[model samples]
Target: MTSLADTPKAPGALRYTLLINAAPQSSQASKSALRFAESLLQMGHNIERLFFYGDGVLNASSLTVMPQDEINIPAAWHALIEANGLSSVVCVSSAIRRGIVDTAEAQRHELYATSCFTSSEIGGLGQLIEALSNSDRMLSFG
Candidate 1:
């Protein structure tokens, strides 16, 4: 008789692509993203990448000035990404509109300068498209 422990389990792998569409300050989108990423890692799943569209790019910006007592969502994301070697792609158009441009662009346009947008790549819809194509599951958090 074969014991239950003798049975071989099939390998299961999951690749997640997360799309964030909400603003950073007014909603819990960033917080949810971080939690979901952590859980995925803990479960031995893979996070293909995080695509920030519309106001979601705010999650990667380093210049967010939340009240000292308030939680800093952007920083939380930064820490997660840095520690886990996660990929962060920000929509260039949305980022600029939201004042999250890099120093070079800010100098060229005389826009407000911040350190947050500099850490992430400035990309377009194509980046999100690629992420979705490469991932086994696409999750949208808003």
Candidate 2:
């Protein structure tokens, strides 16, 4: 059996940005992101940013309603990102397209995406590109 502890850590500090574009219902993207995040920590790498674009903006939407026994992925990701002090950005264009608006802006615009919805600040693809540029390595999970 392969033991996780037996593996040698990667040398040097690496920075990564995971751009997630897949929906929450899609197991592949989320799973891949989780795995990559774990691996980065294991390898002593830093995550500079986790940018949501296109359909990926859905990951930051607080409007997700899951069953009592089901996992709350967006919350999980948010917690992790906050804990790690990683930059979490959702594309403004994509967010609006999917009806995600921030608390202050939502009330100002009188548009509430959903009952549970809590919006993340809007960003753009350029922010993601900047993350990539700042990081040593950029990995796109979706």
Candidate 3:
């Protein structure tokens, strides 16, 4: 198989949007997506948006308690997003359904607490569509 290092690099910085649809600990998809995003940024590409859908909404949850020996995927994602000032958005419906909510959402739904990370925001699919319209490429992992 062709390794990531063997992949051709873009000639110019391109805008990208990533769609992640797997849970943080459920599969390799979340890790792979993280690595890919890091690689892209390292190569000087711009991530226009990160749209987390389906189970991928779990990556934005601050309530995830990872084992000491395990990688904290959500925390990792938050760090990357914050460090790079990237636009990270979780699907509002998916996040709500999975019990991952921002303060506004929690209040709107009459929930007691907010579980979403500060670096990420709960948004609608319109954000995804806008990202798609503006980005040079869109990659989906799941």
The TM-score leader among the candidates is 3
- Name the lDDT of candidate 2: 0.70
lDDT of each: 0.76, 0.70, 0.91
The order of the candidates by TM-score, greatest first, is 3, 1, 2
What global local distance difference test value does model 3 have?
A: 0.91
lDDT of 2 by residue, 1-142 (tens): 1222234546786778888888777656975786677667666677778887777777787868789898777776666665555677888778777776676546766884442233245677899888888988877767
- The candidate that wins on lDDT is 3
**lDDT per residue (tens digit) for residues 73-136 in model 1:** 8887776676667778888888888777776667878866555544467778898888888999
Every model's Cα RMSD, please?
A: 7.6, 5.2, 5.2
What TM value does model 2 have?
Answer: 0.79
Error of 2 at 108 (Å): 6.1
Candidate 3's displacement at residue 92, Å, is 0.7
Q: What TM-score does candidate 3 get on C-alpha atoms?
A: 0.91
In model 1, the clashing pairs are 61-116, 62-116
- Tell me which of candidates 1 and 2 scores higher on lDDT: 1
Model 3: residue 123 alpha-carbon error in angstroms? 0.6
